[model samples]
Target: MSRVQCPRCLRPKTHCLCPLIPRLDSRTRILLLQHPSEVNHALNTARLAALGLNNAELIVGEVFDDLPKLLNCPGYQARLLFPAEDAQPLQAYSSAPDEQPLLLVVPDGTWRKARKLLHLNPLLAALPRVTLAAGAVSRYRLRKAPGPGALSTVEAIVQALQTLEAPTSFEPLLKPFEALIDGQIEAMGEEVFQRNHGEGKA
Candidate 1:
């Protein structure tokens, strides 16, 4: 029989990560546009990110028909968190006292899937884009990263939040993610993990 799953975190009941998931508030609102294909991913970090942040929303789809309303959130300026040739570095952005906080729109999927999202939603692609600083590595040891400086969805959100809201650590948001990684490693056995991902187990 299939193991029972937690209704919230969607993990098998025995490995449920609900307790480690944090409920934190942030000034910048986050809107995650996740591809449908990623919903059942073992980690599903985008869902974790949405659950942990008070001011966040996750919408799963390829074409978002309500882009106008979603992008026009009051008191917030929407910025797409995606890389581009002319992407603005998030570190250089700061809200003035009179300015609105950011509504960071993140796409959750593999690079190809994410790009497909942009292709399907022209307005989403047209938004001003922002990117994280280079050299930050991902802690997702189970999967080979597509490239250097790659990060999981939750990790990217944490780094983006930390940069946008400096001096206020968003580290607690990573508790569930770390637990998930540890659990996966343990399940796969140390020898197998060491053989595959031990080189950069950060």
Candidate 2:
């Protein structure tokens, strides 16, 4: 077997191309609170999103030890990116005045882990929640969701940025994410095809 490492996430480097990632800049700042476990996983989209956006920050941890400082960033309005039964929709938060729209707080992890973060962090729960109305299919083929339209962190951010009418720079950043997912799907399909066809030397 070939010993390849995933370029983007730096895992065994196999089946991952996150390293060829592109950079992006946007008017709105994104703050991703990622779980430690998710950081080590090969399918982490938060890392890709952070790499694409210049104004985005990805912090790996279970708790926001520096919550006070983050909340104090000047001219920034912080809102949690989540789907709560009682939370306001993402469109509502995106429509807020741009003059005070600097920060967006997102929890990066699986549904279970993300929920745990919300339950454990009362401060995060107190923050306003933003739920997205995304129409695009998820790019993460390696990961499964409880339901349809559950997107990777990067896709969710892209949808949110579009809704918020963020700068044009944000659109291009989504390209690499699309590329990475397509690459993975293509590679996997080739492997399956070859296996089924018995093209390899017997």
Give per-residue CA lDDT, model 2, range 72-127, as digits (tens).
Answer: 77977888888778766665234445557648898998888988887877888788
**Which regions of candidate 2 fall more than 4 Å away from where they truly are?**
1-20, 92-98, 166-169, 191-202
List the global CA lDDT of all models: 0.93, 0.73
Which pairs clash in model 1?
none
Off by over 4 Å in 1: 92-95, 200-202
What lDDT is obtained when candidate 1 is compared to the true structure? 0.93
lDDT of 1 by residue, 37-154 (tens): 9999998999999999999999999999998899989889899999999999887246567867899999999999999999999999999999999999898878888898899999
Backbone clashes for every candidate come to 0, 8
TM-score to native of every candidate shown: 0.95, 0.78
Which model scores highest in lDDT? Answer: 1
